[model samples]
Each structure stands twice: as structure tokens, then as C-alpha cells.
Target: MLQTQSNKSSFFVKRPILFVIVVEVLLLIIVTVGGAIATIKELDYIAAIWVSFTPIALILVIYLTWKRKWGSLGFQSLSTITKQNWLYHLPLILVLITISLKGFEDLSVSKVIQFVSFTLLVGFVEETVYRGLILKAMLNVGVKAAVITSSLLFAVTHALNMISGQDLANTVVQIVYSLLIGVVLALLMVRGSNIYPLILFHFLHNLIQFLGPEATGVTYFDVIALVILVIYSIVLIKSLNKKTIKGSIAA
Candidate 1:
């Protein structure tokens, strides 16, 4: 039997735009305050991330328990990935390849454990919220609007780094790069309707970047990567728009 959502008349269900805004604000406060506390305590980055996102994840878990709409939010198994949408999968693969270029700087047991735990938590929390919850809610607006709005908000969330003392220039670049990646991930969620692969890839990508030698500063490769992602995002938006429009007409 199909388990329908119990809260059909709830405020969030009726006001998805407002729901998105509230969620964004809640995440920003939770994450930013956690990061700030970690900094003040001189804690490790791992602790900072765990402190910040773990609560958010648990809250979503509670919501899922109440609603039981896991599949609707793209939390299905990996087998649900649409093998037919091969092109939609390439951008994330390419980004993963780019991230893997960063060679490992540590391989100790504790470090590896931290790497796995940290990356998994980061990937799961972020992918679940941004691509799963936010994107799904924004879809009530329209495909293009959902993609653009969620992606832009995802990028904006990175501004929290500036509060933690990251340099202005690097933070700006990160925001832009995150926005492009957001677009790719959002498109994948909509077309493929599966998020397991996204969570896995995000885990690996972050792990690889952490493994690699720390950059002295942003390099030419960063610029190249950003430009490539921008072009790919544009092509995807155009292609997706055309297909969705055609489908709407046929319906």
C-alpha cells in the first residue's frame, strides 16, 4: 500500500517556498554556530563538521520518521538509478576524477577512520538536505526554478566559511564553484531520481581532497575547473528545459 503523507494540510506542504527559506535559515544557524564554537575551542575540522551537521541530520531523520516519505525525497536504493540517463551522470564523475588528482598526504589508521567518518557524515547530511529536501520542496515551484533556487541557496550556504576566518577571495571562489556543482547535483536528483550515487561520490570527492596535499593558494587548475563546470551546467539546463517542456506539452 502507498503510504501517503499525513500532513497534507501542514504549513510546510502548503508553503514550500517558505519551507525552503526556513530550512535554509535553520541550517545556516546550526552550522555556522557549530563552526564558530569549534574555532573558539581550537578543535579539529572533523569535530567542527560533526558538531554542525549531525543535529541537522537527526532532525531530518525525525521528520522522515513522522512522514515516512523517504522515497519521495530520493532516498531510494542505488538500483533506482536510471541507467538510461547516462549523460546526466558524467559531470559528477568528471568532478570526482578532478578531486582524485589530489594525492594522499596521510594514511594512518586514525586518520583513515576520521576520513571515512567525516566524509560520510558530510556527504550524507549535505546531499540529504540540499539535493533531497531543498530540491524536492523547490520543485513545487517548477523544474528550472527549483534547480536555480536550490543551487544558488546551496552556494550561499558556503558564505559561512567567511565567518570562520577563511580569506575573502578564496571564500568567494568556493561559493562560485559550489554553485556550479550544486546545479549538476540538482539536475541529477531530478532526472535520475536517485541520490545514493550522489552521496557516495560526494564522500569520495571530499575524502580525496582531504587526502591530497594542501594547496598553498588557489591555482590555475581551480579556474579551469570552475569554467568547465559553468559550461557544463549551462548545457544541462538547456537540455533539461527542452526535454521537460516537451514532456509537459505531450501531457
Candidate 2:
């Protein structure tokens, strides 16, 4: 057992990307099989399966195979919020406004609990895997490359939703939107040096989407909201870049 564990550790250290890919494939298999079983049985257990299994698998892999610290995987305690850190709040503001506009109605306690739990799980798992492990692994190449590569991977992973019977057009939109969101969250993680806020924002965004009023079809409002968010993210990234350059010069 010890020799086998050592070999696994060495393998992951030598090929972190491959490790991530293998773990992701495992997750996809688990979700696909679990979801199919749930559908066949008419049970609402997909969220529970994903929420429980993905994180546990990721934690075990990171702990046993990779030997990485949890803090390195974005499990750090909250940091002090400065002006720079405060900009990370923009996404949360947008989420809240969108939810308000959608006019949330009261939900049963059980449904609310389910929505919140699933969103929080998604936020934790995705950030830890993509922004935490993958982004950190790629940083030796360059920060820009790391951010872009991780964000793209994050977006592409949404294609799995298609296998779960999501509409193709909607899934495409989700993929694009996820790319944008990933970039923004990645920058925020860099700026804040903490991933807790990103997890919270991600959870809030998903919760809003889940509980807020559903749209009948694509609307102008959705386009406008997306545009505003993209613009905000661009400005935020530029601002953070400027700060970094100035700090480097002063140092």
C-alpha cells in the first residue's frame, strides 16, 4: 500500500494536468451514471450524488495522490478585505440585482435547502479543481496563460451538461457565460489572494439562477445583463493589472 501510494504521488507530481483530467473523467462518469440511475428511478438525487461524491473524490486525490495542502487548493481562511479586495464584490452585486429583477417567490424549506446546498457544493468543487489546482499548476508557465487555460477548461467542462439532456443552444450559452465568469473569478482570486469570496459569489449566482423566476425564452434583458457583466470584468481586470504594475515598480 505504501509503495503504491508513493508511485501514485510521483505520477501526479510529474503530471498534474493528467491527474486533473483523470479526476474530471471520473467525476463525469460518476455524475452520468448516478444521474441516469436517478432519472430511471424518478428520484431527485443527482444533486446529492454530485455534491457528495465530487468533493470527496477531489479531497482524497489531492490529499493522498498529490500531497497538496488544502490552503493551496483555495481552502484558506478569509482574508482582510481591502479596496482591491472589495472589487471582487461586483459579481455578488450583479447576482443580487439579477435575482431581484427576476422576482423570487417563496419556496418550501426543503426546496430552498436543496438549492442552496447544491449551489454551494458546485461553487466549492469547481473553484477548488479549476481555479485552485489547475490554475496553480499552470502558473509556472505565466499568470496570463494559467488564467486563460484554466478558464477555458472550466468553460469546456460545462459541455457535460449536454449529456444530462440540456438543450444544445442553452448549453452553448452556458459554456460561453461560464468562460467569462471563470475569467472574472480567476482574476478575483489572484487579486484577493483568497478563494472564499469567489466561492460565495459563485454560490450566490447559482442560487439566484435556481430560485429566481424562469424566462420563457431568450430576451433582450439577458443579453444586456451579460454585456454589462463582461464590461465590468474587463474593467476590473485592467484595474488590477495597473495596480500590480505600480506595486512592482515601487518594489
Candidate 3:
């Protein structure tokens, strides 16, 4: 009887996290379906903005609920900026510069407008759903599980773009690359507990991809860079774990 009571207590303790996860997933589904219908009706801009802002709205909703239930807002516990954080963002800047230079030749006013509108809308919406709510739930469950699962979820969501004439091969590549980006973002999320930095990087990444022309194939340099970063990040995460464990034990 005592064991069963303990199990129930544990479940109840985790219910808030689970509730947030369910709400976020449901909202994403509704937004996606509604956006699809709007796109079909040629209301692409409107749909895009709606989908993008939904996540941000949900984040605010969650914050309010959490603040009421707990004493403080959830965002208060997020990671603060550090020297290492700035250094970590350097690679992302390099990637952005390269992408911009490559796309400069074909840039036009109409494409720029479309790209900015869609990219901002999608980035805010998707990151809030996937990284904010989904990630929060996963991290509440287990750190390693959260990192892997969120990354996969983020990657698979990219597959939905295929409905709009994106080639299968290109879609596959984008998904793979997105998974890597997700892994990096997940690392940042786990480190900082804040969503702002991840959101900024994600927005820039999408903006470049949307505005840039002919991002069809992964270059040899990109492949090499991906391999190096994946290996290095894995090692770094492991080292971080060891340090955290040591610190906890000492305390």
C-alpha cells in the first residue's frame, strides 16, 4: 500500500510537466492543420504568421500557469550569459555569413519579403512547440532522453515541407542537417535553461535557408565539419556530465 501510494505521489509530482507537453502537442497539431488549410486557400502569409506566433503565445500561457502554481516564473531559472556562451555562438555566425554570401547573387525584394515573413513565423512557432514545451517535458523526464528525443522530433517535423514541392532527396538532407542543429540547440537548452539563444540561432538558420538559393546538396566541407562537431559535442557533453556529478557529490 505504501509503495503504491509513493508511485501515485511521484506521478502527481510530474503531472505539471506532462500537462504542458500535452497542451503544446495539441496546439501544434491544430496550428499545423489550420496552416495547411490556409495555405491551400492562398492565405500563405496569414497562415504563416499565425503558426509562428502560436508557440510564442503558448509559452506565455505556460509561464502564467507555472507562475501561479509555483512562486516564480519558469523563465527565471534559465541560464545566464557567459564567455563560453558567446564563444559557442561563433560557429553559427560563420555558417550564417557563408550562407549569406552564397545567396547574395540571386537576392530580390519579393523573395526577401516572403522569406522574412515565413521564416520568422515558422521559427518562433516551431521552436516554441518543439524546444520549449517538448524539451521542457523531456528534460523533466531525463536529460539524455530529452536531448535525443527532441532532436529527432525537430528533424522529422522538417519532413512536412515535402507537401509543398520540396524534393524527397532535399527533404532528407534538410532533416538530417536539422537533427544535428537540434542536437546543438538541445545542448544549449540544457546548459542555459533559457530559450532565447536557441530561438535566435534557429531563426537565423531558417532565414538563411529560406532566402538562399540552391541549397540542394551537402558540400564535402559541410560533411567534414558535421562529423567533427558531432564527435566533439558528444565528448563535451560527457565531460560536462562528469563535472556536474563531481560537483553534486562534493556538495
Candidate 4:
């Protein structure tokens, strides 16, 4: 009798969790196939389009789920998390400034344009996938558990990317950096209840990193600075929780 009861409890806990995992796996598979095809065809632009389309598809899925009134399926609580705070944008700006300064020496008009495009593509794709879809789906499991689970998953995702082409030390270091940023993004989503701030910071982060001529070795230091920024944002949020999400939501 006790064993049966325990099994039932486990089933309940695992059910919703499995749904999100399945969705993520599906997405990864799709992207992998697209990437392979792009490689075979030697079409970098096709690959870029394929990569950029994933987030757009995910956002549409989320919107459709919400419209259909499907309960907690694939980022369904968009309405619940639209609240905003002006203070949230402050950290975003500071983070952007710091990152931009590092990359400024290599700045040129063409580089700026490329950086802008990269920022929008990567920022939107990742924010939608990581914070928006993953977090919302995990929330269906439980709030606290969602945050911790998604944070770890976000960090681990970076590890796979790092292993593909990046150095071993950088990959390990990125795992740590990814977790810190993951926590910050998750917390911002919860506290600000909006996606814009996270999106902005993500865009700026990538823009700075990719635009610069700085060597890959120096990126370790950049990660260190990023971690500090995350810590500072947390402290600031704690001190004035009310101001953290003041004017962020769209009508």
C-alpha cells in the first residue's frame, strides 16, 4: 500500500515536467536537422534563417496555446506575467554600457549593423526559449522548483554549445556564467513579470561580446564582470522591490 502511494505521487510530480522536456527535445531535434541540411547545402544564410525562425515559431505556439485556453501548455500564462517596472531597465542599460565599452575599439558601421542583427536574433530566440517558454512550462510544475530547474537547464544548454567548438576551459567557465545569467533572467521574469527587460539585457550581452575584436581568452574576464553585474542587480532588487518592475509592460 505504501509503495503504491509513493508511485502515484511520483507520477503526479513527473507528469507536467515531462511535457516541457518533450517540447524542448523536439525543438532541439528540429534545429539539429536544419543545421545539418544547411551544412550539406553550404548555405549559411539558410542556416541563419532556420535558426532565427525557431523563436518566432515558439512565440506563435505560446500565443496559440493561450488563445485556445489550453491550461498551462507551452508558455500559457502570458497574461499573468505582463506586469513591469522601470527599474528593471536600469540594470539592462548599465550591463549594455559595460559590454559595449569592451567592444568599442573594434566598432565600425558594418560591425555595428552586424552586431545589431545578431543581438536581435540571438536575444529574442534565447529569451523566448529559455525564460519565456521554459520558465512558464516549469511554473506549471511549481514556482520555486521551476526557477531552480530552469536555471540548471539554461546553464547546461550552454555546455553543449561550448563543447561543439569552444575550448574546454571556456565551456566549463560558461556553464557557471550561464547559470548566473539564467538565475538573473528567471528572477527578472518573476519579479518584473515581463520579458522585455530580459530580452534587452540578452541582446546587449551578445552584441557586446560578438562586436568586439577582443581575443577569446579575454572572454573569461567578461564572464567575471557579467557575474558581478548579476549580483549587483539582485542586491538592488532586494533593496527596492517595488521599483524593480515599475513601467515595463506593454498594453
Candidate 5:
């Protein structure tokens, strides 16, 4: 019986994409069900969101243990940050700064702490699942495929927000920009070869959205940032391909 279980585990290890998809589906179910329960029971929604990630974290640990592929999940040292990398990331940094300038005046200490904790958990789980596991799995096909597929999956997953009572039109816009951000993030991960920076950036980005001034509508700055993000993503993708070629030649 142990041997049979081992064989089944090995099968999943050999087919990582299938394993990742299964895990993603399970996570989706957890999020949906947990949100529903929270709504019905009048539970603290923030706490519920945090709790929903517990199973995902557990699954990540199990997969890492089973495959012994922690390094592949961006647990290793980051690649060198070149001038190009800084340039590619500049727009995002600017956006973050602008958002931070919006300030945290009205928030209490406890609320700030809670929001930080929630954003950190979100950053860790989402990046691990999308950029780490899903991207790693899709890399078996090719880098381009991995980037596009993982980004699409990441964007699509945000649809869950609508179920949690988000405005439909706003959610649709979010899904679109999220797809672009997802692509940029995937490319950044490939170029940097580390997930920690992405996690930090993701957390800050989310926190900004939570605390920033109320949006009457999409602003000109938002459109500019989106354009910059797309341009940067393309450049990063090319950089990744060049690095791949160099590695191939070295090998």
C-alpha cells in the first residue's frame, strides 16, 4: 500500500502541471466555500480570507517536500539586478510611491496590522502558487508558454472577487489589468530568479489599493502605469530569452 501511494505521488511529480492545476482547483473551492460561510455566519471577512490560505500553504509545503524542488520555487538567491531590471521596475516603484503618498491617516494601529498581515499572506500564497508552482510547471513546455499561461490563470483566479460582492464592472477592469500585471510579474520572476522581491512588491501593491484615496474612476496615471507595465514586461521577456540563450550556449 505504501508503494502504491508512492507511485501515485511520483506520477504527480512527473506531471507537475496537473498537480498544480489540481491544487489551484482545490484552493478555489476553499476560497469560495469559506467566503460563503463567512457571509452567512457574519464572521470577520478579513480573518476568513487569512484562514482560507492555510490549506494552500500546507499544500505548497507538501509539494516542495515531495518533489524536493524548493530551489525551483525561487527559494534560492536572486539573480543580479542590472540597469535594465531597474528600468523595467521603475514604473511600479513610482506607482507604489504615489500610493504611499496617499497616506494611512484614518486607520488604527490594529487595523493597519491586520491589513499588513492579510496583504503579506496574500502575497506569499498567490506568488507561490502562480509564479512558483504554476510557472515552474509550465516551464516544461517553454518560457513563453509558461509566462502567458500562468498570467492567464492568475488573472482568471481574480474572478473569485466578484463572488465576494465586488462590483461587476470594477471586477472586469481588475481582471484585465491583473492579466497585464501577472505577465509583468512572471517575466520579473524569470529575470530575477527570486520570488521574495515579487512577494514584497505584491504586498505593497495590494496594501496601496486598500488604503489609497477612493477612486472615482480610472485616472490618467493609472492608464500611464498600465502602458509602462506592458512595455516593461515585453522588455523583460526579451531579456529572459537572451538569458536562456546564453545559458544554453554555456551548457
Candidate 6:
């Protein structure tokens, strides 16, 4: 187990981009297969299968952290949101506003618990992989490269939606929105922020996003989110400099 862990961990440290590609491809496959399986399986059975994924992800994180001897993945604690970096949270606020506008479906206790658990799982896993692992890996190239590459890869992750059921046009827009919003999340790591709050952000946003089964997400929020993120990204890009690459490598 130790040797296997070392070998796997070295693969990520030695070839970060390749590791990222493999991880993304695996994610795509898992989601695709899992989605397909859900249709053919009972709800409780499918839920059990999906919930099992969280522990597997956790084990991977623990193994890698141990093998690499990483002191942190920016997830140990939450940092206070100060005036300096407070603006970076606007996208999350926008998500709240958008969800409010679109509103939510009636919820039972079981459904609310399900949404919380599901979104929390997503938030923890995705943030650790993208912002924590990928961002730290890419920093060796350059700060700009790290930010753009991590964010772009993360954004492209949403493209898998098209394969499942979404239309092409909507998928394209999702990719764009995800790309821009991804940059903000990546920048939080660069700014020496903790991953816990970022995970919480994901939790809240995705809870509304994946609310009830009948939820239609194509509200006016999409257009407004796109515009705001585009302009916000431009300003952030301008702000990147030698000072921006502050976080230590995940290794």
C-alpha cells in the first residue's frame, strides 16, 4: 500500500498536467457511468452507490497528502473574509440572488438532507481536486498559467453536461460561466485563502443549483452571471503579478 501510494503520488508531482488530465477524464467517466446506472437502478440503490464515492475521494486525498507529506491543501481552516479580498465572493452572492429569483421547490426533510449531503460532497471533492491540487501543481509554470489552466480545466468539466442531456448551446454557456467562476475560486487559493470557505461557497451554490428534480436553471441569472464574471475576470487578470502566486505547492 505504501509503495503504491508513493508511486501514484509521484505521478502527480512529477507530471502535474498529465495527472490533471487523467483525473478529469476519470471524473467524466465516473459521472457518465454513474448517471447511466442511476436510471436503471432503484433510487436508494443509486444513492448508496453515489454516496460511496465520497469516502473513496477522501481516501485518495489522505493517501496523497501523506505520501507527498503536504502540510496543507488549504482546507485545514477558514480564513476571515477581510475587505481586501471580499470582492472575490461576489459570484457566490450572485448565485444566492439568482436562486432567490428562480426560487426553490417544496422540500421534505429527507430531500433537504439529501441536497446538503450531495452538495457538500461535491464541494469538498471538486475544490480539493481543482483549486487545491491543480492550482498548486500549475504554479511551477507561472502564476498566470496556474490561474488560467486550472480555471479552464475546471470550466471544461461542465461540458460533460451536454453528453448527459443538456443542449449544445446551453452547454457552451455553462462552460463559459464555469470558466470565469472557476478563476475566482482558483484566485482564492492564490490569495492565501482557505479551501473550507470555498467549499462552503460551493455547497450553498450547488444546493440551489441541484435543488429539486424539476428545477429548470435557465433563468435570467445565466445571462447576468456571464456578464458579471467576464468583466470580473478581466479585472482579475490585470491584477495578477509576481505577488499573486502566494500559496505553497500542494506537494
**TM-score of every candidate:** 0.87, 0.78, 0.71, 0.70, 0.83, 0.80
Clashing pairs in 2: none
**Models sorted by lDDT, best on top:** 1, 5, 6, 2, 4, 3
Cα lDDT of model 1 overall? 0.77
lDDT of 2 by residue, 1-251 (tens): 01244443554445766766776676566666766766776776545466445655566555634564455445656654466568556655774576457667688999899888888878777777777767655553456866787898898777767777778877877787788888887776666556788878888887887787774555555666677669867876776675552322121
Tell me how many clashing residue pairs each candidate has: 0, 0, 1, 6, 0, 0
Give the alpha-carbon lDDT of every model.
0.77, 0.66, 0.60, 0.61, 0.73, 0.67
lDDT preference between candidates 1 and 2, better one: 1
Best by TM-score: 1
Largest lDDT belongs to which candidate?
A: 1
Q: Which residues of candidate 2, in runs, are more than 4 Å off?
A: 1-14, 45-68, 240-251
lDDT of 6: 0.67
Compared with the true structure, what per-residue lDDT tens digits does model 6 show for residues 154-202? 8877676777687777788888878877987787667654677678888
> lDDT by residue for model 1 over 168-241, one digit each (tens)?
89998989889888998887677666778878878987888787788666776677778778877777766665
Clashing pairs in 6: none
Better of 3 and 6 by lDDT: 6
* Candidate 2 vs. true structure, TM-score: 0.78
**Which 10-residue span in candidate 4 carries the lowest summed lDDT?**
242-251
Model 1 CA lDDT for position 244: 51
lDDT of 1 at 68: 74
lDDT of 4: 0.61
* lDDT by residue for model 5 (1-251), tens: 01244533564436867866886788789887877777788889687886688667777778778876566577665454556655666667865775566455578878778888889889989999898878766665567877888899999998767876878877887787889889988887666556777888899998887766676566666676667677867777666667653332121
lDDT value, candidate 5, whole model: 0.73
Candidate 5 residue runs with Cα over 4 Å from true position = 1-13, 79-88, 101-105, 245-251
